[model samples]
Target: MVPSIRFALRGATLLAAVSGMVAATMPASAKAPFRDLNHNGKRDGYENPDLAVDRRLDDLIRRMTLEEKVALMLHGTLQAEGGRGIGAGKAYDKASAQELLSRGVNSFITRLGPDPRTFAQENNAIQKLAEATRLGIPATISTDPRNHFAVTAGASSETGGFSQWPETLGMAAIGDEALVERFGKLVAAEYRAVGIQMALSPQADLFTEPRWPRGVATFGADPATVSRLAGAYVRGFQGSADGLVKSGVATVVKHWVGYGAEPEGFDGHNYYGRIAKLDNESFAQHVAAFDGALAAKSAGVMPTYVIAEGVTIDGKPVPQVGAGFSKPMIEGLLRGTKKFGGIVISDWAITNTCPEQCMAPTAEKPQGYAIAMPWGVEDLAEEDRYAMGANAGIDQFGGVDNPAPLLAAVKAGKVPLARVNEAARRVLRLKFDLGLFDNPYVDEDEAARVVGSAATQAEADTAQRAAQVLLENKDGLVPLSAGKKVWLSGVSADAAKAAGLILVDSPELADVAIVRVATPHEMLHPHHFFGSRQHEGRLDFRAEDEATKAVMAAAAKVPTVVAVDLDRPAVLTLLKDKATALYGLFGASDAVLLDLVTGKAKSQGKLPFELPSSTKAVEEQHPGRPDDSANPLYKRGDGIVLP
Candidate 1:
């Protein structure tokens, strides 16, 4: 006799809760029956009894109708309609949320404010809304990478919550997989405490080029290193348990296929052309990291907006004139070849930018552009976004404004029913695997206690130690005396507002000025392609440069230290000559730097990529080129010792 659906669900929930209790009681080393055993990384295949759960999930999914299934595939973010605010605002209040749910919205992603209590309260409110709905479909709250330092907005801002750790690239420089895993585990614990079930992070993208602003979020350039770190991170964040609890929030390994290989080191910029003779090896290496993630059974994969060569769907290339809707690339490469059975998510607003003709409007038309003057393409329409993304096997739509159109399209028979069911099944399976149905809530009091707790603080401290990469410390130039009346300059330091050597009111102040440079790609107008060697202008020096020079001249009177905050290494010729000492702080926090300078913590990070001396050098050893012999700068792995 077939088991009752409700009975099976109750049993599943009980089993999951019991497993959580067991995990709390058992020692970390003791092997419980529900502990994940495939050891291949992800929770794929029927290796252990957990396979029974998969069958039950399939049974549950099979019972759902086409409309209900389609609803499950739509995941909504709290981003405002005009991109002005986060979370459901006055315009999108609980009533609006209820309306969306009535129209078939299946999932919701909420942000955590800086205050842990506030975050919990907001989450509880959202959860209450979900419970009030007819289907009782649980809301899955996801936050930005909040493990260390708050990235998007300040903690006081509505979008902020959780202590920020060092950037992922900084973590990679430590070269400690164990440390990476620990970071993930701590992040997971915080998420669990807050009732957040999914973390849209551990950006598995490789940092092939230093100039990419987002590179700081990646592990490093090496595929193997990224893969190992990514896998370990998945294991750490997702927990090693089979039943649930003490297990990790589901890990969403992101920027799915190819994203890290943007030309000229900028994200969401020009796609690498087929004829550009780009570094295919570097591009291929990105897949290696995803392979690691897949092996670990990362809960989800996110695709990027960049187009890759020879990657197409239905004979159409991707991210090009008319290719954002490519099917083969999404289904064949990501799901088929990678054997990824998890959900596939598109990057923010990517689907909206689909279709060849869609363009985002701009004020002016630049030279050498193919499209009309000043008009930007809106890649994919909202309706087309759902149809194309779902048909292409995308399990969920992230950051989508109004999912009503998508649902209406499905109801009108515009989208295929089978496609909807397939994507929905994956989403349900993940929720089930996460044990969301059984333990859908988190302890609000416990959340406040656990977030940034002593244990998490310790882990953050460890991450700080691992993330410090000393770019240059010539002849023991570092470890400066704490009490010395040192001159510090730069927007970052000046923002601190301490007394020292002062320069002009601008960034050019100090006994030492730390200048933050723009990413290389941002330096160019949108029209310039990768091969353009035109150095139309010299590097723009900020007031900070003048201040840095003044400080260096005054260095004879008093010692000076120049701190450089960078995503990649760029030559500051002024620093080469004027400063008493220069140090490169690649996205390290103020506290981390303070600890390093004051000897509170040791700087142990190493360079994860090469630092170019000049734009000329960058042009010579262009990222798209096959050879690296032409560049003159610090080779990969070049860094100074702080001790």
Candidate 2:
């Protein structure tokens, strides 16, 4: 027998609710086989799972207070210590989270321990707290990209026993939209297993600036390629054709518009984010990358921490403020023209008044001496900042816990109650569509079963091999014969042997020299470790840097193969002429690299972005444009197919 729960609702009820009230209809006896606690015989509008989502959402919003409505628009990070919530050194127990839920917050971001069981267990605890609330509003848990191999503080979390994959740029190297989509499906299943409903990713920003610190997270520089893959990625996460289903993870296509082009190649933490000379056509191409995603119905968007410079909206220049605070940009461009109605969340802490905490601060350098990133609204009061963002069409503020400021804005007449209700409606509507209220918990054993299964790892392995771009194989030096005596650097002795080659310590004793080197950058400090990941300013190597000198010295000795990890493009002009072979890697382990070199797998990847010949080319290119570097060393899509 087909389940009655699957039965569709029929009536003029939704139309009546749209007119602002749902009149009750009572049957003599209920056959719904569940509680109609309000005892109307027919379920109440809010309680009826059968009602249309719009009617149910209206029922809830009309019942909420100005404070509760405002509370629904704020998201904060919940820190956990030993399975217990911790905030401000208080016992912030589950009871405390339950209390907070009653006051109303439906979204949270958190990092869990590297154990899948612990992640599932802790998530269930939080969900139980939400279930006990007055309205039983299910909390949507969000997380940064956590399935990558590398874990940098504040940016990415380590794969907590989840299926590991290469960096997003590496996937772009493979140049296969279907593979990227498959990866998306695998990531979504793992996320749902652990109760993570939203992914703050597929970073839709173009990697036009090779030196931007966060370039590694992007899907490379070509708008067409990135656009195709971005759409596929969204479809992979949020189920295709039919919107987001239970197995899918809601995608928040991010850094809305453009965030990749930070002026002077600095990270977009402050005024350095002001982009210049951005014309209409260039703006269209940069945004083309997100076109597929927006068309695919991405559930949310996040504005970057930078201000877009010189953009005209409605025949006037856009206000030079952060994207979150600019009404012309958010309301005019994204909301009106782009036609996106999903939740619009500000990048973390955009509303904070204190400079020290607002700027990217490190544990070592706790006092943030760098300029705070309130952008154009630096002079506005905290309540006014919240008011401006809210009125400008931002649906929620990220990384803020308190609801007092927004509530104050409403009371001060700076923001209307209707606007607050509008934001609340969007947030609650998404929760209902995700079906979070029905089943928010996970089965601990099932989570362990699906997270890092062997099948997922095999796909990652195949992707790693597919992602290796063979840029140069001079004199047929690649696919080196298996029995060759090899002098390897940057790879361990056992790893060399695993590739079935004799390991020689000195270049003099070997038939050929194979050296693996990373694209080097000058280190800057006294900031957050995640900030350190950003390769600011010059993307070059001097003749005398110790690491560069050593790698060159290896090339100087014998026939050499240079494997460059293109985390950001390396200035390899000096090494290009000397090496017998060259390769570009996005992100892969030693084994994957060895397999490509030793003919275990064929090279199928290509350059996702241009590799500039000099830092001057990088500096001269327009930050807001795509594929615009001056005289790049290698053009986009450059790769050698093996004969």
Best by the TM-score measure: 2
* C-alpha lDDT of all candidate models, in order: 0.56, 0.75
* Most accurate candidate by lDDT: 2
Clashing pairs in 2: 213-534
Query: Alpha carbon lDDT of residue 368, candidate 2?
Result: 42
* Residue-level lDDT tens digits of model 2 in 1-643: 1121111221235333522322234343644443222223345566667788888888877766677778889987666543432122212245445545655776887666447776788788888666545455678988888877556544576677888788888888887888988999998989988888988887888777677777788898888878888888889998884456666898888887678776666766644444534666666776788887888888888887777665677778778878899888788889898998888988877787746444546565543433345777878998999999999988989877778778889889999988988999988887878877557789988888889889998898888888878988888998899789988878777878888999887888888888887787765543533345455656676788665676677777778888888888777787788778888887788888889888898778888988888888878888778778878888889998786
Position 410, candidate 2: lDDT: 87
lDDT of 1 by residue, 1-643 (tens): 1111111111234445655665666676654443222122222233233456667566556555555566666666554323333453322255555555554564766653546665666666666555444344557767667654324331112324465677776777777888877778887887877777887766787765445555566777777778888887887888752212335788777766556555555445332221111334555566777776778778877766565554444354444321224466567777777777777865554444322222322235322222211102244455765676666667777656455556667877778777777777778777666666545667778878878888667667667755665655555555654443344444355433342223344322432333333322233434432213222222322335554455455554544555665455555554555444555565556556656655567777776666656666655554432224245355556666554
